[model samples]
Target: MSNLQAVLKQYWGYDQFRPVQEEAIRSVLEGNDTLLLLPTGGGKSICFQVPVMTMEGVCIVVTPLIALMKDQVEQLKRRDISAAAIHSGMNRHEIDITLDNCIHGQTKFLYVSPERLRTEIMIERTKQMKVCLLAVDEAHCISAWGYDFRPSYLLISEFRLLIPKVPVMALTATATEQVQIDIIDKLEMKPVRVFRQSFARANLSYSTFLEENKERKLLQILKNVPGTAIVYVRTRKRTKELADWLTKQGLRAAGYNAGLPFKERSDRQTAWLKNQVRVVVATNAFGMGIDKPDVRAVVHFDLPDNLEAYYQEAGRAGRDEKKAFAVALFNKIDLEDLAENVEKKYPAMDVLRRVYQSLANYYKIHVGGGEFSAYDFDIQNFTGTFGLIVNETHYALKLLEEEGFIQLSENFNNPARLHFEVDNRQLYDFQIRNPEFDTFVKLLLRIYGGELFTEYVRISESELAQIYFVPELEILKKLSFLKERGIADYEPRRDKPQLTFLTPRYDAALLPLNVFEIERRRERDRQKARAVIQYASNKNRCRTILLLEYFNEMDGKDCGVCDVCLKNKKNEPRPEIDEELGNQILHYLKSFGAVTPRALSQIFENVAEKPFLQTLRYLIDEEIINYDQVGKLTLNSKYHS
Candidate 1:
């Protein structure tokens, strides 16, 4: 075996590489700018990781996912490999220590978010490290045409210019031809070799069932498919409702979302991972860092907004190279809901400005103030006071964040803090005079030490409660009393999202709104929504083939086991098959998203109407074709030959 394979086997306990993994690794080791398009669970990390193990310097991995970074770093550390990550959630002291480790040759891998790349500290510290390679995960985010675009990704090209000699590899699980081309151009990659593995999932049976009774259908599917599964819902509320319903039905399930406390989220995830829970009903937040290989099913309780997200989420199953099912339950109302969601995602420019102005007023920041300041924001409180719809308000805040005016971090947790307002003598006098509070004060001093005197120190209320043999509420009450006595400045922990103003507030009317870009994004989003609608409403097309074609992989054959294929098999065979005529009909439908029978008949003008009509019926009866909601003919997507 080669040294790279040996290293992989030794560290990861793998004797072989997944398709395209070794080739991508070889390109990176040879110092080539490579673009890798592997599906989810395709082992994209090992492609750069193994090569970095072979190299002499630290590999800088740029990714936007903080949770994924922490997971990978922890995994590496467990394997005795040195790695570290820097993210926004960490304090300056922690970040400084991590960066120092990287600079002093104590770390081999440094994972950082793209937003941090622009920081002066990151740029300076990075200059001090001997960087071997640069790897950009989720590279599609760099493309404006891509589904999820982040302007901060544009900074990567600038960072690349600083380290011109370092070879860069961009990796993404889902990227279309347009997104692929845009990634290369935007990253300014020279002579980039793009390695695209087939987007087809052989082990995954993709099926979409349009049923009015979705809950019943969901229960049936869960009962039929017996293994670990994930039921994706649109909102946190839905997650809880569905998970509760599932649990009451005697299934081991739990709800997961960003709104849950950090400890609870971790516990639920651990339970699910350990098979203590069979299913996790969650929003999109629950699966990025998850690496379970035996997930037999992934059911979408609600339709995702785009095909890319659906494909990634479904791809999570069958990663162990075993047969699995990805089922999507939808109905007519879902299509309407998808349309409404699209509207909410891209609201009017004026509406966005109104929300921005309202947020500024709510924070009570004067114009030209609040720049570079972050505050705890309560979305429910803001919306209730303003009488705004929750969903629209969320979208508006997101748009503002995207436009670079401010940042909104959902489900943020600010730790409890305390700073001494008086010197040691005063604190000592108060402790002696008030003997009832002496033990708690001494415990705080012993635990946090001198940091509490200079600046705020994070303290765990639960820890304090345990030490003092008091309820958490009592601990809080005591802390409040200490603050009232001017012994210390104590701030309780806040478990809410934070919003930071990146720039000074401007007049609501003149908020520098980009009308052109907003309109462009709206049009693009409309197209995406239409694509998703087409996929869900489709009844005849092969689910796998349709998904592959959406990602620009057109040569894929049918999956042969989807709902359409099963229906075709059960129905009686057609009388006679006309190969040439069927090919023409399939070609026509493929060119247009969908077509009506009358329009299709007119296309074959020379052919007699009687024979053409008969042939169309034959294709329909044979299950090679089907009709959509409005009588538009579509190809039966389950044929696999």
Candidate 2:
């Protein structure tokens, strides 16, 4: 047992690595900068994680997704590995403690967002740590040609200078060849080894349907395919509407979107994962970092903007290597909407400036301030107050984020947290001095234990209220008083989207928006949307081959199970229908007076279905056989006489 295998077994309880996984891990362990291109559910995390465990210093992972960062950190901790993440929502104290742990070698894995890499504190602390590996997840985001181009990812190269000797591993599930080249060039990876798993999903059958009544078609599809499924929609409203409709139709389903309360979302997700809900009707926000391997079908209710996103989302199914279906239902209206969305995504420059100015005013940030400050942003209130259209305002904010002026995070639930500021002895003294709070303090200690004294612990005020036999408001008041008295550090829960100013606030007219880059991006998006339209509208090409070719996989063969392939098979010319076969069918009808198609088929069981059906058609067209009012085949009266 080698060290890599030993580490994998100890942590993951796996006897071996998935295909291409061990080789990728070996490349990283050999101290070479590596680029790993594995499809969704390819276990990319383990490639860097297992090797980092064998190395001497902490591995720094840079990702753009805060949700994924938190998920991975919690997963690592479950395996008893020391891991921490620093992102935009963290307070100064939280960042300080997390970085300190990394520097002091108390943390083995440190996950930070790309924006955090440029922070002075992050830079200084990273230099102090003995960094072994620098892993860039979603590395394609650094590429301007990538579908999801984040300007903040460009700062990673500058951060790389601080840990020059550390081997870098860039990993992404979906990246075109152009984007792949850009990632390496942008990151300045030298002597790089690239490991690309083939993008073809042999087990998944990709199919598209042009339907006039999509709701009926969708229901029919769900009935045809069994097991767990995902029904993806374009809007949050549709998620609930469709899920409720599915339930009314006697299917166990639930709606999931980012806007739902965190607990409800969590509950729905848990129910889906456990198969308590057979289908999850959701938006695109549902599937990141979720690993349910037995999803038998992923049905798209609308066309995505690009093949990259569609591929990633559809690839979520059949991860357990079983045969699954990825069905896309689209109509003419969807294609038009997709085409129009390209223009809508890039709001006019004037609208962009207006939105920026409105955001600054809403946050009460004067010019030359608000740098690095994050605020809870309510988009509805902001647009309503400023008399702006919500859709246009959202696009403007997205444009600003893409241009690096601000960072807009999805609505997230930050639970209430507590940490004791005093030592156990001091806490006891405080409890004695403030005798009124003695019982509550004791209950906290009894319920949460000693970890709350050393670190911030997630606490539920409602649960505490239930336990203490008091109203939830009383629990909140007591927690606030404890913080006021400096007995404990209590942070109340927050559930809102965050908007952080990446740079200082600027006057609306002099914002220096990158018009040329924006134009190029708009063109890129238009091209992507056109490709999506073509994919959905195309009738000649194999769906799997089209997707593979889009990703630059030229050697893909036609998946025989796709709708196109099956239709082509049906239409393929077969041996000409034999006259003897036609005569035999007519003679049978004459001898029996009338016979059902099923009985006739059984009599010609040795013949193929296509050829037999063709013979029957020939006989009927020539008036040799006909169907009676009872719908049974019989010889024509003229022939019988």
Best by lDDT: 2
Q: Give per-residue lDDT, candidate 2, residue 543.
A: 90
C-alpha lDDT score of every prediction, in listed order = 0.84, 0.90
Off by over 4 Å in 1: 361-373, 385-387, 411-495, 502-509, 569-641
Give the per-residue lDDT digits (tens) of candidate 2, residues 1-641: 98899999999999988899999999998999999999998999999999999999899999887789878988999999999887777778767877888888889999988888888899888889999999999998998789889988999889999988889999999999999999999999999999989888877988999999998998998999999999999989999999999999999999999888888999999999999999999999899988899999999998888899999999999999877999999988999999899999999999999999999889899999988898888889999999999999989998999999998877476779888888989999998899999999999999999877656777999999999999999999999999998888898987788888988899999999889999999999999999998888888989988988888999988887788987886787744788888878878777888989999999999988998998897687455887776889889899886
lDDT of candidate 1 over 1-641, digit per residue (tens) = 99999999988999999888899899888889999999999888888899999998898999866567878887897888988787555556556667877778778999987777877788888888888999999998887677777767888999986688899999999998889998998888887888878888877888888999999999999999999999999999999999999999989999999888877888999999999999999999888868999999999989998888999999999898777999999999998988888778877877888898898889898999976567777789999988888888999988887676776767456568677778899999998999998988899999999757654566899999998888999999999998898888777876767787766898888899777876777777778889988987787778888889988998988777677766655574655656698788887776675787778877898888767877887787566887776778888677422
Q: Which stretches of candidate 2 lie over 4 Å from their true place?
A: 446-449, 572-641
- Which model scores highest in TM-score? 2
The worst-scoring run of ten residues by lDDT in candidate 2 lies at 620-629
All candidates: CA RMSD (Å): 12.3, 9.3
- For candidate 1, the TM-score is 0.77
Count of clashing residue pairs in every prediction: 4, 0
